[model samples]
Target: MNHDSYDDNYIRGILNGVKSIAMVGASPVNVRPSYFAFKYLAQRGYDMIPVNPGHVGKSLLGKPFVASLSDIGRPVDMIDIFRNSSHIMPVVDEALTLSPLPKVIWMQLGARDDAAAERAEAAGLKVVMNRCPKIEYGRLSSEISWMGVNSRTLSSKRAPIPTQGMRLSLNRTSVGGGATTASDRAAKNRSEPT
Candidate 1:
């Protein structure tokens, strides 16, 4: 996988597949980008575990913070690294220690370590560098358009109105349209037979 530029499916697949995330360098401060990202993912129904040595015993969005990835005590589908480029390798090395390795190692915006990414990929983990999952999720789900940004996702069909909040669906025929909010999907699930 090209860590420099990721295909939409590559990102979408990772986002859709990952059920739980251990966010390293997560902050308790509400204004921090990591906090915002964590909150958004939690609201979207992803199990978010906060990891930060300094903030251990505290909580971010009510999720208790662990000192490190090893302390999570549960399997996480992805490791979202919120630290700077220089700190990425240590985090990646630590994440690699888990028995069932995470499916992805995602470096936040402005954070990139080619060596670290290469190692993770060689270990059979997908890698994303210098990108923010929050922003990508918003853009890919067309929720960013609500913020007046041109999401570059155009469609002739109208998007399904969200049932609550500003949440949109990751399942789509294209990037912008098809599936609606999570609540709507849940309603459909409740109505359908197994």
Candidate 2:
């Protein structure tokens, strides 16, 4: 079986076109990857609908957690899956069964379902398997600092030196008022030696 390369324009178009996302298996826990990715998308203006059977009726990031796709009344532009590959077929089936099919079906990193993706593609939906949308967005837009390396744009002024186990403090003085804000103090603490 031959796998085709993912088109850059196709990926970009799906990313730009998506407005609302139904995140399946979204956990309320912040330590989870799904939680962070969900928060990131929500912060970036995507309407996030968390889907978790165990957490139904609970609120995550100010949005209610739904048990299943069928429970959601509003239109879903995309279904970003965080579930395992074994359980993905049913989710794809449900998404495709909707009156208006979702624009995209994105499988999280390390989660790949070729059959489900093929079904989605056959149903005229854009399929992204084994890809993290949040990572893609940051990478494509150059928002990823790579620990302040690689690109010499805004982060070229000062290089991040290896301090090993050493602690540093940063200081900043406010203009006109001569008072420093909390952020300024924090920044100063980060750059100065303890």
Candidate 3:
């Protein structure tokens, strides 16, 4: 529960477990951080809901925007807060009101509210502060290394470029920076010298 540095397993567990997410303060503008993060998660196969009172009529990545978390109409596994620290409490408060409360509350980069994190944790929700799930997902999947960022992992066996292209998955081996399916690992093992 150290808000300063998160263990990778803690993040990976949440990322791998959560299938649906509600992103509050999402922006449809492609230049905005929220836009790409939303796109990234959606691409990874998470059901992404965009929430912003200002853009209720618009859609991003084919998902309609809702005015608030309360309007999502479907249960989301996590609530990702893109709002400023000062505005986080209200979002956390609203999340606590959901019938089947979300399992996690994730505050994006540069956005943290210790008080909000505390309350959500009290309500049995896992709390992550000032971290972007997109970044976490990429780092855990070694997708960040594809962008030339060092992932601090090295391995003798490299993964094959999937015929489907570079879609990231949390299940990938962190060392190789490529998607590694069970069959891919089997192929690798078969090719290695005895």
Compared with the true structure, all predictions reach lDDT values of 0.81, 0.72, 0.81
Per-model tally of clashing residue pairs: 0, 11, 0
Pick by lDDT: 2 or 3, better one: 3
Provide the lDDT at 152 for model 1: 46
Please report the TM-score between candidate 3 and the true structure.
0.83
lDDT of 3: 0.81
lDDT by residue (tens digit), candidate 1, 1-194: 65445567778888889889999999888899998999888887788999999987788878899999999887889999999889999999998999899999999987888899889988999998877899888877878878996554655566787543344666544543322355345544543557
Superposed by TM-score, candidate 3 places the C-alpha of residue 193 at a distance from the truth, in angstroms, of: 57
lDDT, residue 146, model 1: 81
List the pairs of residues colliding in candidate 1.
Answer: none
Candidate 3 local lDDT, 1-194, one digit each (tens): 76665656677789989889999999989999999899888877788899999998989889999998889877889999999889999999999999889999999987778888999999899999777888888777777777996554454556555332244555544443333355346544644568
Highest TM-score against the true fold, candidate: 1
Question: How large an RMSD does model 1 have?
Answer: 11.5
**How many clashing residue pairs, candidate 2?**
11
